[model samples]
Target: MIGQDDSRLHTAVLVGPEGERRRARKARRQAAAKVETDARRHRKVQARAKWEAEQAERRNTSYLPPAGEAGPAALRTPGRFRLPKHQDTSATLAGQYPFLAEAGLGNQGVFVGQDLYSGGSFVYDPWVLYQRGLITAPNVVLAGIVGSGKSSLAKSLYTRSLPFGRRVYVPGDPKGEHTAVAEAVGGRAIILGHGLRNRLNPLDEGHRPSAVSDAEWAMQVASRRRDLIGALAETVLDRPLSPLEHTAIDLALRDAVRSAEVPILPMVVDRILSPNTADDEDGRLAEDGRLVGHALRRLVAGDLQGLFDGPSTVRFDPSLPMVSLDLSRVAENSTLISVLMTCSSAWMESALSDPAGGQRWVIYDEAWRLMQYPALLRRMDAQWRLARHFGIANMLIFHKLSDLDNVGDAGTAMRALASSLLANAETRIVYRQEPDQLGSTALALGLTGTEQKLLPGLGTGQGLWRIKDRSFVVQHQLHPAELAAFDTTGRMTSDSHEFRNLDVRSGIPNDRRDS
Candidate 1:
């Protein structure tokens, strides 16, 4: 009876409100577990069904054989197709790949000729190139062997530029080649030599630009005269002037300026040799300028006397389309040629300084000869460096690139200057080069092996133009009239072709026979 009472108490506690809530929660958990189990079973069955469908579809599909189709439908060889691996530089690959030629400089410049690789028209203008940011420097270095059509190319370049409002100035023409072209284009060529009547007063005030003030013009004239006299003295001395010599020149130049309206070379020579009594206090000034005076006297009273001694007979007209100083008559005397070129270059500089003078082509023909003189080389270097500022393009024409190597000793200042001329000139036009010059030319121009090799095979009128980093092989085209005007081999070809007297003012050949 006691055990039955204890069991009834336990059952009563279990059947209380808390026990009832626990039973309800247990029932909900059982329902959720059954729902989750049904969902998992459903997912498994769906996966199985999808797998069976894929297996059936895969069995029905057909694929290509490992060896490809057979008979006439066969597209593969009997053996495995394979290609040998190849590798090279992009430069070489560019040439090997078809349809990879350069698009070339656009057609806004002067029409030069066709690009060999691109088979398209190749036009070039340094100013145009500079304007378009194709080149930084407006100077150009052109080298070629004789009969390679470099002269013709140069003539064509400048003459073609004339129609575009650019002027041509050949500071010195050693062979008188440009005389005809100058006159043909309505320009003047100042013919100066031992027997010629043309006189250039280095001290005379040169062409003054319209923009410069009178005070600035006077200062420029003074500075140019002083420098011109010093350069001439150095050319005659074949060395640079010392401080004492410069002082002597300056004092004597001042004295000459006060005494004369337009001082000629002789007047300056007189003042330099015999300085004023008041100026030479210690009597040492005479000795100081003795060597310089005697050196400059060469231009006034010595063998170089007749050319620069007197006042101006023919003036430098910068307004003309072109102006060339013909030095062919004095070609045999290299020293005289250098001296005359110095004066002519000075005259041209005054015109170049004029911002209103427009664009001009300053051709340094027979550059090898000009490079021999340090004074001239320095002047040329200055002009080249200032080309962009002066709104001009300077073209240096030479026989070979190695000619610059012969300028001075290894690592000398003159050599550096000569090399700088090449460095500054972003445009390099190389015509047919002799095989012996390949190594040095390639080294100087930074040409690739292929470009270097191409040098030897270039034909006449065919040049390898390296404008900045880009390259093009151009075949220069010329008109029939240009061919006749630019021909330099006439003397060798025709026995009757003689240099008749040229009109003093016009530089055109006349019937006046050579006296």
Candidate 2:
């Protein structure tokens, strides 16, 4: 009986041990499965986060803000990281804020120091502090590459300034883009050419004679004496004209123009080209004089009547905001056209210098061509000097940095002369360019890191804009119809019923004959 009971206990102990081992194995398997499941969940979360980050980058790179949408301050990041307001006033004081934004004024108006933007976007709102007021400074230099939309930007600004009752004059460069703006804004476009009749009856007979007095003629003749001397020095002395030499030449030219009985250009040319003048002058001066003489003679005899007479041909109502000189027809004579435009500017400045009741803006497109001419350079220099007094604001546009260098040493001097204009400009806009040009442009405009980064990505009509205290890149949205209205061919086509119906003639008007 004892032996049987012992056997039963042993059997029970073995069964209990087996059951315990099985239970341990099951728990181990469950633990391993939970670990695997956790691993999978973690990997899925990481992948989702990575996907979100990639999506944000794509959005930032390709997204354009909706028209009229305030520009974004911060780019989106992965997950739920909230960002502060994009514009932080921490650096800017609210009370004496230099920036002023007035959207109701002519589409959109932003005044930064002397820089003005019309039809500009809210993206540019951060740059309002940089514009210069008319009373503060006078010159603006726009440097960009071709097709960068510099001309379009200038035209838009000019049109915007119109409602403010500013007198705007545009030189008739080969690009006649400004003419459409002038016509649209109720201003006249004066086309200067031979046989063109004056639309404005400035003279009693509707014609102004080209003549000067005997004393004036004698003074003009005497003025050629310096040019003759310079020509003699350049030809004989083999020297370049110094600043003093240029000044003397200017005085001489002025005398000749003021004193001449007939057109002074011929006499001026004759004096420079004379053999005696060359003999007494250095070879360089003589060469330069000959070049000048040839250039002047061609200008005078050529179809340059339009530039000198165009302003008088059209009566400018002070109430009108814009005036464009259309010179597309004279493309063959671009240099001559530049000369004419310079002369017209001088005439306008003289007329507006004395208490012109309001402010004015004068824009020069393809300004590089004008830089090639000494007379135009001098005129621009004068504009810089007297901009404040005349309340005249000037915007000079160029396509390349090298273009400025093409105008000789005078170009260098002109660049220096333009420095004040650049410094005083309240706003500076730099469009996309080659990599090399990008650095130089950024340095010139004093852009920050954020602003600099925006340059490479900017599209057409987009650029880095610098105001006084802050800067950013913005895509400018312009009125497409207004932009399309100006033809690139420089011809005001009759396709537009309004432009066709106008009784304006092509070229500066001559004295009217009884018609």
Number of the predicted model whose TM-score against the real structure is largest: 1
So what's the TM-score on candidate 1? 0.80
User: lDDT by residue for model 2 over 251-331, one digit each (tens)?
Assistant: 445444454533334444454555343234454444445554554444445444323321244554444566677777666
- Which portions of model 2 show Cα errors greater than 4 Å? 1-138, 193-295, 302-319, 400-402, 405-415, 418-421, 486-515
By summed lDDT, which 10 consecutive residues of candidate 2 come out lowest?
200-209
- What is the per-residue lDDT of model 1 for residues 411-484, given as tens digits with 9 covering 90 to 100? 99999999999999999999999999999998999998989999889999999999889889999998899999
Q: What is the lDDT of candidate 1?
A: 0.91
TM-score of 2: 0.53
TM-score of each model, paired residue for residue: 0.80, 0.53
Cα displacement (angstroms), candidate 1, residue 487, comes to 0.6
